[model samples]
Target: GESVGLHLPTLSVQEGDNSIINCAYSNSASDYFIWYKQESGKGPQFIIDIRSNMDKRQGQRVTVLLNKTVKHLSLQIAATQPGDSAVYFCAEKKGSNYKLTFGKGTLLTVNP
Candidate 1:
C-alpha cells in the first residue's frame, strides 16, 4: 500500500465481533483482487482473493466481496480476535498482468 500524504483508514472492533473493511479501487478493468494482512514488523500475508467474475468468496474466517459495478471491494472478518489486529490491504490486478495496485490499507484493532 502506497499513500501520498494520506493516512490509512482505521477500524476498531471488540474481540469475538465481526469486522468489515472496505476499499475503493480506481481501475474498473482490474479483474482480480487479493487481500493481505500485515502485522507490525512483518510482511503482508495473503488472506483471501476474489475475481471480478465472482461476487464473493470465503476462506477460513474471512470473506471477500467484489462490486465491480462500483469498483468497490470489502473484507469481512468473522469473530475477530486480537491476532486479527493488523493492516489489511486490497490489491488489484488487471488482465494477465501479475503486478497489482495496492490501496492504502486499513488498520484493524481488535479490543478484548
Candidate 2:
C-alpha cells in the first residue's frame, strides 16, 4: 500500500497481549476502507475492509472501527505473538474511484 506521506511510528508489544492501532483520514467522501498487514520483506496483504455505509468490520484476530464523524479509524489485534510482528496499514477509497490513499504505516513489534 502507498504511504499517505506521514509514517506512523512503531509499536512494540509482549506476546499473548492485544494491540490497538489508530489512524485519521482527511477525506469525507471515502466510501471504502481496508486494513493490510505487511511483514518484513513483503508487501501488504489485505486483512479486512468496510464500506462507508458500515461503521465496523472484523477479521481473524483483527477488528476495524470507523468513525466517519471524526474521520478516525482504528485496528485492534488480539493474541499478540512474535509472528504477529509486522507493519499494518489502513487504506481508504473515494466514491466510484478505485484510487486509494494509505494512512501512515504502523510497525508492530511483538516481544516473545
Candidate 3:
C-alpha cells in the first residue's frame, strides 16, 4: 500500500532558538495543509496553515512552507520557548472534503 503522509517523530531545541519541523505528504490531490501543536493532556491547537496556491504563510511567530512538487511541508517557529514543547502534527485536506488526513506527529522538546 502507498503511504499517505509522513513526519518526524521527535525534535529537540534549545530555548530561544528557532525550530523547524518537517513533514511529507503523499496525497498530491490535497489542497490545504495545517500545522497543530498538542501539549500534554491537551488537545491539538492550530498553529499555522498554507494553501496549495501559496508556497509560504506566516503567523505571529510561526511560518508554514509548502512544496507541492516534492510533496513536502515545513513549519518554522522563531525563538522556541519551554512553553513551545509539545507534539506537532500536520493535516491535509483534499479538495472540498470535510475530513482531513493527519500525519504522524513529531514530539518537540524545548530545553530551557
Best by lDDT: 3
> Each candidate's lDDT (Cα)?
0.86, 0.83, 0.89
Which residue pairs collide, candidate 1?
none
What's the residue-level lDDT of 29 in candidate 1? 75
Give lDDT for model 2. Answer: 0.83
TM for candidate 2 is 0.90
How many backbone clashes does every candidate have? 0, 0, 0
Tell me how far the alpha carbon of residue 46 in candidate 3 is from the true structure, in angstroms, after superposition: 0.9
The C-alpha TM-scores of every prediction are 0.91, 0.90, 0.95
The C-alpha RMSD in Å for every predicted model, in order, reads 3.0, 2.8, 1.2
Residue 33 in model 2: lDDT: 85
> By the lDDT metric, which is better: model 1 or model 2?
1
TM-score of structure candidate 1: 0.91
lDDT, model 3 = 0.89
lDDT of 2 by residue, 4-103 (tens): 3223578898999999888778788788888889999999999889898888888889888988897888888899889888888889888888788887
Report the lDDT tens digits of candidate 3 across residue range 17-73: 999999998888899999989999999999988899999999998999999999999
Worst 10 residues of 2 by lDDT: 1-10
